[model samples]
Target chain A: MKVALVQDTPRLGDVATNLEKTVELLEEAAHRGADLALLPELFLTGYRLGDLVPEVALRLDRPGPEIERLAAVSRRIPFAVGLVEESSHHLYYNVAAWFEGGELRHVHRKCYLPTYGMFREGMDFARGDRIRTFPTPFGRAGLLICEDAWHPSAATLLALEGATLVFVLSASPLRGLGVGRHNLSIDTWVQLLTTLARFHGFPVCYVNRTGFEDGLGFGGGSFATDAAGNLLASARDIDPELLLVDVPVDRTRDMRFAYPLLRDERPELVHRELGRILGRTEETP
Target chain B: MSAPVPLPMDAPELTRQLEAFLHEEITKAGFSRAVVGVSGGLDSAVVLLLAARALGPENVLALRMPHRDSSPESLAHADLVIEKAGCPAETLEVTAPVEAAREVLGIEDPLRRGNLAARVRMIFLYDRAMARRALVVGTSNKTELLLGYSTRWGDGAYDLDPVGDLYKCQVRQLGEHLGVPREVLGKPPSADLWPGQTDEAELGFTYDDADRLLWLVVDRRVPPAEAIEQLGLERDLGRTILERMRRTQFKRALPLVCKVQARTIGIDFRYPRDWGL
Candidate 1:
């Protein structure tokens, strides 16, 4: 599958402007012959919303002009855009909307919401409880938000559900890690992604935002790595750029056979533990 | 020994009081001399001049340790500042040591190489200070300190700091009054890490804007959103500052030590500055 990563800068709280820019970038990627396009996390409303979260968040089905425009733009190539999704009953999510063939196909709510430091995700977003892998025309793909990728359990579950590719929408503030007078710990996250891709035997298409929002900087180190954890495309730091890569579906099957992590799984030790989730424990600790 | 009185931010007597306070601390700490890295940058220039004033020109040693990539202008500015401030000067070419250390550590990246240079300079300053029984005074200003802009165990490491509270721009103003060379003050600020690399060039924000915003956020106690709004800064720029605010918390704090007792170092067992007195 040929995918293009849009490392475009989104204006904070300028939903119309950001959505327009995202659509334009997606179209630009499609024009460049990409079968699919990926935009950074919270591309629709921009990442830094501070106190404007409630005002800017939109219901998942509400066209709201921005969503409709995105649907209109997705006439040919499938595209994924990050947004703050509002549901009924005041439930909000750090969400990504997958648009394919001029329609919204799937909405992936972020499972793991980060609450550390500047991020107070728990106060704003209701956690997503379901893990799903969608069967796209091109391939079986899984989607996760930024913090969700940090959890190996999510990736493992997606892989078990036969996902060959994963798209991670990240609004992770750069924290001045890579470009600073201090030691940058963001590279540690890169290693984590690499391990996840290798273990799951799935190519991870990671996209991150750029520009500063509310004094929080986004280091745009977006990249795509193959199932073997070989980096295919990398974006610049704290700058806007587009990254494109092509991977054949067969490449994943080849890697899985070579590594055989899927086949050699010790189900007796691990899968049996999963059975506890389905059981109601009578004893409380 | 009495506790330091809290001084107003812009009090005119600050310089004199600061000098006296630092001198007393140095004597009590048992250091006979003081060493300062002469970067020719405003931050270093202010600190160097302060050290000279506090502990006479003879007692303060100014070391200009430049790497191979350091600009000649930066070095020349250092010499001019030394001449103007009347402090003793020494130059240590760090290229050989840095190269050897890089080889020994197997560090190959440009970033790590720059960090190694900072650490090497610190090592030289510390060693020379130890030889002279001097303390290495830090040159970092409040802005850089707040942003965690210095490398830990590198620029962040120091025995004492005289100009740690002043912002970068404030340091320039203070340096001017201290009779620092105009050429040194006027020159574009740089760490002289790589060829033609300027501090502002790497930071992606001018020191003036960064420091001003920092004062508003940190000293003035403005919220991140309100600070950006009042400053009329771009959202991305504001976000960048907030991210730095979040990430650099470690730089402003003592290293995290796990607590195994009732009272920890920074958390509960805090003591007055003049506790023993």
Candidate 2:
């Protein structure tokens, strides 16, 4: 299956323009023969929303014109895009919602919102408390926002749920200088995402936003990897790009059978161990 | 600390990022062109060159606004940069306005005179920017910004800053790697306000020393006593840099607003400068 990994600059707090741009990009992706497309975290509203969160947020339950437009495009080519989702309870969440067959299939509110050091997501948005993989035309898949992939447990949970392909969306900032031309943050992410895909025997598609907002820049170096962790497609640094890659489902199947690491995994024992570590099972046994 | 631990230098990558920053911030602010005061020093030179690369040499307007007491070499080095970058430039002397203010106000102190000269240059740059429809970019580095060495609303004014986060030593290192002229990099650092004015002489510490001390205190977040010990610096020297940073806190922030309303700007009323952009 052909996947379009979009790394584009979202105009901060201007949902109208970004929504228009996203529609155009989706049409372009579909024209290019992509089976699916994935956009960066907060792809519609932009990251660093501060007080403008509510102003730009889309109500999922009510299905505004923007959400309806996205659903229409998803019918052309199944796609996932991130946005500031205003829940029915009137709380905001940084979310990635997948659209397919003219319907909202799955939505993942970011499980981990970084609260410190150049980030204040926790202060702005409510945390998502659940993780699940949903059925898609491509097969079982899961979505993760930027910080969610930083924790290994999140990916492990997705793997345990039998996700074959995972899309990790991010608005990661451009920072740090080491030996390479790319900043440290971009380099670190490629390594981390590649390793997780290899361990889980699943294809991981990572899409990050580009351009600066209030002096904080999000570097665009979106990439994708095969099940065996070989980089399939890589985009440029600091520019908007539509990186396309082919997901070899046969390789995923081969790797999962050849590796068989997940086949023998024991989540029940792991849960009990976690309960013991938390001191909840000390006297029960 | 420990000879500053040799700050990392990646000339190509840092150049790429800063240039990209200029393109993003400038165009986002609704201008395709930029104007920067070319002081002939490393900081301004770097800013000008990077701006040229990002916005194209034709788009950047280089201004050399020098006072009467300003060193001749300032103009000469600035010419060299303009020629090398191939950007359009104008040499507007601020001496007339500065002298007018000096005589009318009967300003006797050299310090006050220098401050007047800096602000006068700002007038020329901003006026030209307004006429040319270009945004002014600042040249102050992190060390000078932290120490509040710039005159408020004078050399400190700009629509955007590209070098504010980089330290003086890092700026010098980056300038060298990007093929900045040796004469510009080799000379002692100066503000060129007066004939004999040098930044080190006024600050009482070289950029090397200050950078090492700052890396420990600011970047590493070490306690002053511990950082001073690691740098093998005199307690007084380290203390002065720290004190200067502390004293200049006001320069780094917006004007204070006392709250009477439910929300006040910069206190409770918070939004990004890029809000709605």
Candidate 3:
């Protein structure tokens, strides 16, 4: 139930340095007795490689040596690191490699690609289609990327799929006074995720990166909250730091029972709403 | 217009075209009158001139909001231009509101009091606009806008900006072309929020330096370090310009809205206002 969130900088287009830092942070987390550790988005190549993506992208199965080493290292505790994964037809993906029990448990690709000013993820990589939960020794776990965390569908679907805990990996840019004013966004993110958790009777772990990359800074205020939306742990702003929190399933169940958001079943209407986004072709009664 | 040097195209012709364009946009937005703060600085002078040409001098109202410590010459310059442009002018000294707000909020710092001055000016401008059913004409130039120099919800608040695109130097040229007073065009540009508080003194970079660098970085889309090298400017100055651009992003965005439902606005459903045909 103990988790560690790493707030470290990724050197631009330097995969070797990124992996080295990831291993060092994972070791540090394990030393602190953390059962699970999370890293940032695109940690292998950093976030500044706009055109270097093709050169740095590694095939999913072609990450053979790196995956093997990380899996072996995960024998002590479960770890997740962000990287570029090459899929079928040579398409690239921003993927999270979840390692546990000396093996690769799941490779989750980022679903949402922010296409606003200075971001063109949709043009560079393919979108993730699958939305499902993976069984972990701790609970039914789910994964999401940076922009994915902003979408209600990503987390809501995961909750509907019976995930007791959700892990969100992000690499957001900082914008001085304007950006700091939205510090409550971290709290808002946790609130919505916890609302889903309480509605489905679960907990959520939201992780984010810290420091600047190519003049774009990260606030690094990563946090975890229970089903009742209480802050279990929080990190500092604009710095490299990690926080470990012990989240219990019994706590979620007890709070959910008291809140009874789950007991007030309205699945019929909610499913109809989901049908709208899924489209008429994919809808079922 | 022809007297201003280096004019291949007559400044009056360019001013006419820009004014016509402004009129069209204002009509499209369903507005007839404009309210602007006249500081006697180059930026506001150019804006007031443009507003007079766009919406007529009679329809353009100039508010001279000066603090207690503001230069008397600023008011003189503003009055001269107001007379020359044939526009109606009003004066609202900011001492009363500033003192009252400082006492109520227990604000002791001079900087906080200056911000209150900016907010008071905005409040008066908006009040005039509301009473006349006009739009508050903004006078911030490209340099200040790019550097994020204006206070948010204070001087930064405006309904329509007539001169936000021109740099400070360009504004001075345009002001001269539009027949703004010589003293007004020659004087240093400041917000006049506080006594003897010059813009360049606080910004640590001259308007000319900031404008040239910003023009290269934004209009030319050149990299920051390379732009600094190409312009032969100081490294720290260039870095400050880039950092300001990055930091002021929120002022350029729509309000943030949490998407509790699919196809919600802001967080999702981010299509153009004119997206679906």
Candidate 4:
């Protein structure tokens, strides 16, 4: 499957301008023969739209004209994009929507909302409790927003649910110098993505945005890895980029067969251990 | 065992990066100009130079705010910067405002007086910023910020900071590279809050020593025991630095907002300061 990852800056609270830019980038990705395109988390309204988020939040189930225009574009080349979703019940969620054939295919609301340091998503949006994989034209895939990917269980559940690929949408900032004098956050993310790809024997596409919002600077460096954990392509930090890579679908099945780690399953043991940690008695089978 | 290598800083690269960062931040914050407090100290001098370079000297306003006890050399060095940088500047004696506050509070202690002076200077800077429609660019270096040596809400309040990430030693290096006068660079670092006051004497350690130890402990995340053993930092010094960092962590963040509601400002209703403004 050919995928395009957009690493671009979004103007805060300007949904119209951001959507126009996204459409333009999606067109560019299509021109490059991409089967699917991925945009960074909150690409429509920007990640740093603090108090203005609720005002600009989109209702995906009853999307406006701007979102409808994006859905139309997705008919040409299926894409996944992130935005602030306002439900009919008036609750807000940090959501990633997969669109194909001018329709919303699957919507993955972010489960983990970061509230530490510079992030306050927990206060801004309701937490998503469910994790499920959905079928794509290329294969079954799972979607995880920025902070959700930080948890191993999030990815484990997706892989267990028969997802051959996972897409992580993020707006992570550039911080502390790493142990090897590298970009610390980017290095840590690379480690996490590669570990997930290797352990689950499935490919992972990570997308991040670039540019500064107030004092915080988002480090782009979006990337993709094969099922074997080899990096295929990456975008540059601090610049707008549309990274396109060809992911081999066959690699997932081949690697899983070769490793057989998934075949040697232990869910009952995991459940028992979790029950012990949670101080609850399990119903023994 | 090999000696621990000092962290390398590239002065030119850092200056270029900071200049661009300040320019973007200032312009993005809806201001085309910058207002900077110019002290004789290297930190202020470096910030003034960077702000001038970022927004051009014509767009930068350098303010020389001095209390009655402020060193005469401070004014002279500040004048040198104004003259060399060719930026517009003004000398405002902070004696009246500081004295007024001091008299009302009946405060004679040096620390309280110093804090008043710092805040008084900030008031002047902010007034100038508002009058000229410019953002107040900060000059606090990383060492001072990490050590929490700054007077909170006084020298710490800023719309943007160009040199906050650079350590004091790195600031000196950048200052020298930016052609700040040799006299200003040569002088012992002091806040000039009182007569015969030097930063090193007050803090009980030189910036070079503090920078090295802090680089190891904070940036390198070295264990305290290992930092002392490997970097040859005194245990007490390391402990003091760590303790100051711990105590002043609150100073670096927004005031604690008790989460009683669904969305509390600084708790859940947080957004970037530049959002929609």
Candidate 5:
């Protein structure tokens, strides 16, 4: 399947303009013969919108006219985009929505909201409690937001639930000069995604935004990896780009059969180890 | 005796990137002007020149603040930068307010007096920033920030910092590239809180040495023991710099909050700085 990752900048707190630009990019991706396109985290409203989140948060369950327009365009090709979601209960969430065939296919609320050192998502949005895969035309796919992919269990759950492809969306900032002329953060992400792909034998599509917001600069190095952890393509750093790559859909099954790590999986052992580490059996005072 | 530290990246390229970053940050923050405190040292000199180029000389405000015991050469060097950068400049002596506070508090130590002077200068700069509707540009380089050498809420308080990420040695390289006056660039770096205090004398190590170690230990992610061994640095020096970084970590972060509620301010209820502003 041909997938396109749009690494674009969002003007902070300008939802209408951001949506307009998103639609334009989605059309461009479709024109380039992409079957699916993924955008960066919070692409609809932009990241770093601090207190402006409430004002621009979208109601995705009952999406407004702007989202309906996106759905209309989805009839030509499927796409996933991130936004701040205001639920019916008025709780806010960082969400990625998948639309195909003029309908919302699935929604994944970001499960892990980073709250430490330069991130405050735990305070700003509600955490999702579930990880599941849904069927798409190409294959069964799962979605994980930026911080969610950092946790091993997030992808583990999706893989166990029979996902062949995982999409990771992020708006990570550039930090730390890397070891010997490398960007430390991007290198770290590459290590993480490659490991996830190699271990699970599932293709991972990672998309990150680029551009400056306030004092933070998001480094764009969006990429895709095959089930064998071979890098298929990567976008540019520190610039808006659309990365297109042809992912081999059959590799997931081939690698899974060849490696059989998932087949040898020991969930019960993992559960016991986690119980010991978390002290789940200990009595509370 | 030790191998020389590798020189920083191309100075002109670094200077251009920093200038573009500063320009984009200022204009994107909805401000067309900047206010910088010129200390007649490499760090501040670099910032002043960058701000002048980024925001244009007409939009940059250079404030030269000195305390009573401040070296005369410091002022002269600051004047040289102002003349070269062609930015609007003013001189403000912080003797009165600093002395007034010292008298009220009954403090006699040079450290306390220096901190007071730094805070007083911040007050003057901030007030001037408000009057001119410009942001107070910061001059604290990464070395001072990591070492916590800056006075908290004093010289540390700023609307934005252009050189905070650059190490002290890199600042000098950029200053040279920007054509900062040789008089200012060559001076022994000092806070000038007392008559004869120098940064290297107080810190007990040269910036060149410190920056090299920091690049290895912090940027290169070499283990402290490996860094000390590979760089042939004194074990005490590496330990001391790491210790200083650990001690000053609080200065780098917001005050800790006891998280009793699900969404505590600065903890769980955090948003980006530009969230709604």
Candidate 6:
């Protein structure tokens, strides 16, 4: 399956504008012949929602016009867009939703809401507690928001549950320069995505947003890696661009068979050791 | 005593990021143009070039506000930057307003007099920015800002600062990469508040020495007791650097509001600076 990494710039707290731009970029992705397209985290409503959360968030249970437009776009090319999801109650979540053939297939709410340093996610978003893989038109897939993929266990759980492809959506901010060739934030992400892909034997498609939000610039180095952690396609710089990555979805079987690392697994030892360390052996079955 | 090495940087990468920063910030603020004070110093020259590139040269208004005692080369270097950037340029004589303020306050000390001059320049820039529908771009580098070496509301007041994160040495590195005139790059760093005032002489430390210290103390978060020995710094310079950073912490932030409401503005009722933008 050919996945297009949509490195888009969403205006802060402007849903109408973001929805329009997202549709236009999705068209671009389809024109480039991508079967699946991945947008950055919070692509519909922007990343720093703060007090504007209620104003910009959408209820996905009864998807709004903003989501309906994307679902319409998905009739031809299945795509995933980052969003701020308003729950049935007043609570909100950082979410990524998959739309295929005018149906919402799966949704992944971000679990790790970073609250330190330049981030204030914990103050605004209710943390997600679920990690699972779902059936997609392309294949069984897993979706992860920016910080959720930072934890290895998030992706590993999905792999164990039978996901052949993983899409990591991000809105990572740009920071730390004057030391390396790349911005420190972008550099770290490249390494992290590669490790996740190579270890899980899945082609990882990463799409991060670009542009400045309140004087904070985001790293826009959206890219993909093979199952062996080799770079397939990359962005030009920290500006808005579209990157299309060809994923050999069916070949993941060959990859896993060649390595056979996941086959010789010992999760009981881990669950029991983790249980013993935390003094909670009750869940160690 | 340790002689601090000049900081190194990826100049091309910083320029790309900084330009994007200016473009998005200025656009978000609802302005397409910028107003900046161009003293013939390295920091302002670099800022001028960056602003010019971010918003095309025609969009940037480079103003030269010089006092009577300001060095002739200051205006000459300012001219060099304006010419090189090919941006819109203006010159202002700030001597009258500054002298008037100094006289009314009965100020005799050079430092106080210098501060008056700095504030006077700020007034002209802000007023011009208002008339031109532009935002004032700051030229204060990280080294000067960390040391609190600028007038609180004078050179420090700006709508946005593209080069604020850059230390003096890093600014120089970027300036060189952007092709700032050699004469401007080679000149001694000065505020030009008076005839012979220089930044290093007034601060009692070189930027090379202070920049590495700032990085260690602030960026790396090294303890003073440990850093002094690690860098082999002469004891007093290290002490004064930390003191300046601590004392001037108030200048870097908004004025503190008393906690009367359950959720005060700065303390708790926090929203991003780019709210609804």
Question: Which candidate's DockQ is highest?
Answer: 6
Superposed Cα deviation of residue B171, candidate 2 (Å):
1.4
Interface RMSD values, listed in order for every candidate: 19.4, 1.6, 18.1, 4.0, 4.2, 1.8
Which one wins by TM-score: 4 or 5? 4
Best by TM-score: 6
TM-score of each predicted structure versus truth: 0.54, 0.95, 0.52, 0.79, 0.75, 0.96
Ranking by DockQ: 6, 2, 4, 5, 1, 3
**Per-residue alpha-carbon lDDT of model 6 for B12-44, expressed as tens digits?**
888888988888899877999999899988898
What's the TM-score of chain A alone for every prediction? 0.91, 0.96, 0.88, 0.95, 0.95, 0.94
lDDT digits (tens) for residues B245-267 of candidate 1: 68988778887879999988776
Clashing pairs in 5: A49-B275, A50-B275, A123-B268
Error of 1 at B12 (Å): 37
- Minimum summed lDDT over a 10-residue window in model 2 chain B is located at B1-10
Ranking, TM-score, top scorer first? 6, 2, 4, 5, 1, 3
Q: What is the lDDT, from 0 to 100, of the residue B73 in candidate 3? A: 84
Residue B56: error of model 5 in Å?
A: 5.8
Residue range A173-268, candidate 5, lDDT tens digits:
876432321345677888899999999999999999976777777878899999999888888766689989999989998999999989988889
Give the per-residue lDDT digits (tens) of candidate 4, residues B1-277. Answer: 2265566655664565577678777886788999999988888889999988989999999999988788898989999988878899988999999999999999999999999999998999999999999999999989999889989899999888877877887788888889999999899999898999999999887777678777787778888678767767677986887787789888799788788989988866766776753
Q: A67-178 in candidate 2: lDDT tens per residue? A: 9999988889898999999999999999999999998889999999999988999988999998899998887999999999999899999999989989999999987752
Ten-residue region with minimum lDDT total, candidate 4 chain B? B1-10
Candidate 3 CAPRI level: incorrect
Residue-level error in angstroms, candidate 4, position B41? 2.7
Proportion of native contacts found in each model?
0.00, 0.73, 0.00, 0.34, 0.25, 0.77
* Least well predicted 10-residue stretch by lDDT in candidate 5 chain B: B8-17
* TM-score for the A chain of candidate 6: 0.94
Return whichever of 3 and 5 wins on lDDT. Answer: 5
Off by over 4 Å in 6: A178-183, A280-285, B1-6
lDDT of 1 by residue, A1-285 (tens): 888888876766667777677877887898899989999788877665544567669876666776777788888779888988878877788888898878888888888888877777786678988788887777889998888988888998898878999998887664321222111424655777878999988888888876554335566678888888877767765567888888666678899989999777676667677687668567877
